[model samples]
Target: MKKGWKLAFLGLLAINVVVVLVLLIGLLSPIKEEPLPKASPEKEAVEFHVQSNKEDLNRVIKAFIEKEKAKSFVDYNVYLRDQVELYGDIAVFSERIDYKLTFEPEALKNGNVVLRQKGIKVGKINLPVSYVLKTARDAYHFPDWVKIMPSDELIYISLDKMKLESDLRVRADRIDLKKDDIRFTFQLPIEQ
Candidate 1:
């Protein structure tokens, strides 16, 4: 109630307001943006390895098949089975599929690798490549990506046209099938 007490109360209120303003400014201040560190040109070409087990490959294939299943009208039980074999630079890929027929197509050895219709077994009969392709075309239509060459007895996947991760720019140097997992060696380049 006295002048000195009133002045002291006003001083305390001013201090509180100043403290609150300082706290608000500190909390709402913009964060500084730091540029990402650039790799030197000399070390631009860096080699990296991706080691994937059988389970990982199976899981990825299953996911892809599941996505395709919705659009696909033909009934099938197609899926990848075990480890992907790598002999030299070529990778061997195989899968089991049932298209009104249950069979495990032979391991296809094209550039990328996939399952081939050449030596697919149906029950006890081993169907020819042409027959398989004809059946697939007339009876069960395949996706646009699959290119079946009945003459060459070759089945290949068109991965070159497929879009990959935008940030990662690398080419596969070599693939090695180790005892436990598959190792993929990739050569990545740094930007100038």
Candidate 2:
């Protein structure tokens, strides 16, 4: 090829290489206004109950409802139809609470509640349930001898399990809890 023609061909080749390099660089750069939407965190509600009398259990539950209602939050009633065992040292109560809750603006897609009874009688203590949620919410309170882990808050809600004298005769649409240490499975939705 002649000198002038060779020079023109080389110029064309250089322009093609520059165009390809520019295209590659633009593809690698993060484009503006194309950020992904953030994912919403999930909330779970489980009811863990301990052994107690029905009347006594209802009283505290009622108070808890009123308290939540007072805060402008909707209250849900739960169904109780399970056998429980109460001993001199300990007691256990379990129930399933399922309700369509609407907390407004930020609605909770769904919640699972595990209400566990603290096995404490109210002869005259009359302590608020919210207060109890913090200090000694269960039988698994921190021992006085050693400091409990920072996350291990003192609560009387440590319901391990209780052996039963007879078979349980209740049917939970979600789960069944016999008077023994049985690990519960699945979310319970007891239609109240």
Candidate 3:
């Protein structure tokens, strides 16, 4: 009986030793992790040509002015006729005076348009063009892209400076009022 008891105790001790060794090996092993993905390269910009007539361009210009009017303190209207016409009222000595400014539109190669002041009519009062432009610049809320240059007698419309959604950009290809041919190019950036 003593011999049998000694053998059973030795077997249980050997089993416990094997179990502890396995547990220690598992605890000492290093963990493995997955690698990260690489960044994608930037894609090229895509260009699309848009062609419209004077009527469509007029509607678009009217809509743009109407949209901007909501954010402006003074009301104004811009339309494409034989030339670019801007109609607005300016306050002089606490009195509102109606004014009509006609500009000859000249499209540049760098996607910008310069409106050279051809003529101006101010409510039966003969005011200097510079003074009226200065007054409009000071009083009316114009968009950042619409630069009113009083000294130069021209309004610079910087299309590149105008921001659009989805990283879109626009360029004026051609704007011939006499021919009624207006064209624009829209640049869209491709997603990576």
Candidate 4:
């Protein structure tokens, strides 16, 4: 080969080698994952009680239905009738939902209930409610910190996850549901 062509080839090869090495170094570098701040021992624990009535809950559901209607994913007609029953620390809720999918005939799904740490239970079938709730997160492009949990009769939103300023772990300790009102006792970790 000619001298000029040989020099050009060697120069390109050296550039390729340098690029590969830089990429390799970047891939091999240790990834530093920031640890969650530790909770302070002296911090005081906080408990919050939230209560809502059936009418208010229905209003929220209506608003959600309207929002979904605006999306127009599929032609749908949905009606949800929720009934709550209390069983000490556990609350059992039953819902009679009427839905029509696309152009098909209307169908009814009844006796849906919420299970602790579990998703919605539809009749004898169990559904991954998180998968359904994830659609909302994807639609609005929400962050991972925003958590949603849906049950057959109720939906739980983790408030602590929304708080970016503090690493506060929170969960529902007790749930009480009645014909008139639904109540929740949330337990929060002590912040540092």
lDDT of 1 by residue, 21-128 (tens): 986675454433323222222235566777766567667766776676576554444433332321111111354443222222332222144433323554444645
Query: What overall lDDT goes with each candidate model?
Result: 0.45, 0.32, 0.78, 0.39
**1-192 per-residue lDDT for model 4 (tens digits):** 699999999999999999899866754544333333222232365867767665675576467556655654323323223332111111123443322111111111211123233223333544344433333223332233423332222232433443423554433333233334455444555756
lDDT of 2 by residue, 1-192 (tens): 699999999999999999889866643543222222222232242344334444554465466545544543223342333432221121222432222111101111121122344333333345333333322222233222212121221212111121113321111122233332222222222333
Clashes per candidate (backbone, < 3 Å) = 0, 33, 0, 0
- Expressed as tens digits, the lDDT of each residue in 1-192 for candidate 3 is 999999999999999999889766654543232222222232377999998888998887888888888976777898888899989886645888888999999878777788899999999877667666766776777887777777677788877767789878787889999899889988888876
RMSD of each: 25.4, 25.4, 29.7, 17.2
Q: Give me the runs in candidate 3 sitting further than 4 Å from their true place.
A: 1-43
Which candidate gets the maximum TM-score versus the true structure?
3
Please tell me which model should have the higher lDDT, number 2 or number 4: 4
TM-score of each: 0.46, 0.20, 0.73, 0.29
Output the better candidate (2/4) by TM-score: 4
Clash pairs detected, candidate 1:
none
* Residue 154 displacement (Å), model 1: 2.5
**Candidate 4 lDDT:** 0.39
For model 3 the TM-score comes to 0.73
Report the lDDT of model 1 for residue 14: 100
